[model samples]
Target: MKILPYHPSVLAQAQLVDLINYCQNTEAHLAIKMAEQADIFAIPQVYQQSGGNFWIAQDAQQIVGCIALLPLDAHTGVLKKFFTYPPYRGQPVRLGAQLFDQLLNFAQQHDFTRLVLDTPAAETRSHTFYEHHGFRRITPNELAVAYSYPDRHSWLYELQL
Candidate 1:
């Protein structure tokens, strides 16, 4: 598999949409309200507006995973849209780790002092993953007040770089 930064082109955007919507509908079983506001379809624009970046992992030219780093301020960023296809989640595949490592590297290169993310409270696997990667759970109030997208039940995690 190969990891690449997202391009703001029709093909790239379409593939991103496909990967995210598939994950939300199948794996996440997210409520329609959550899925709709997840904003998977406007990735390029969202990243562009936030002065951030989106990345994708591909296997044989098929998008299998994705992650985004959105700038919340000069010293902080918010990790978003992190997902790996089911078949690639664990063991030898490890697509999620690869994507996460890349995002961390990018954050360091960009001089971000901290990285924050919100995940659904029930995604225990994801919580474990984040914790293993040096993220610590933080109260919702600890998150920047400007980040209002995540619901009240979402668990927040932060990594201090």
Candidate 2:
């Protein structure tokens, strides 16, 4: 498996869509409406336009995992699109951990003072993963006002760099 920075291209965007939809719909059982969003198709541009980055983990030619870092401000970043294909999740290969570590390194290099993320409240496993990696839970109301999209049931987490 190889972890690489995402390159802006039609093909790369398509792979990201497939990976995200597969994880959200098939694995998480989230409603189709939850997976439909314009940002899914413009990952590189959305991230790059804001001085951030997107990354993918691939095995052979297939994308198995992805993560994005979006700059909320000079000192803060928002984590998004963190997912791992079913076959690569919870295995000895540790794909999620690798991607997360890479994200931390990138945030540090960019001099971000804090990183925040919002995940579905029902995703208990994800909560544990974040907590184990030093992320602390925060109430949605406690999140920055710029992070206005988090729903009432969203689980918010933050890591201080």
Candidate that would win on TM-score:
2
Q: What digit string (tens of lDDT, one per residue) describes model 1 on residues 4-27?
A: 988667777677777777776667
Model 1, C-alpha of 115: deviation from truth (Å): 0.5
Screening candidate 1 with a backbone cut-off below 3 angstroms (N, C-alpha, C), the clashing residue pairs are: none
* Candidate 2: residue 141 lDDT (0-100): 69
Looking at model 2, report the run of 10 residues with the lowest lDDT sum. Answer: 31-40
Error of 1 at 82 (Å): 0.4
TM-scores of all models? 0.89, 0.92
Model 1's TM-score against the true structure = 0.89
103-156: candidate 2 lDDT, tens digit per residue: 889999999999999888888889999999999999766777486554737888
**Candidate 1 global CA lDDT score:** 0.82
Model 2, position 148: C-alpha lDDT score:
54
Best by lDDT: 2
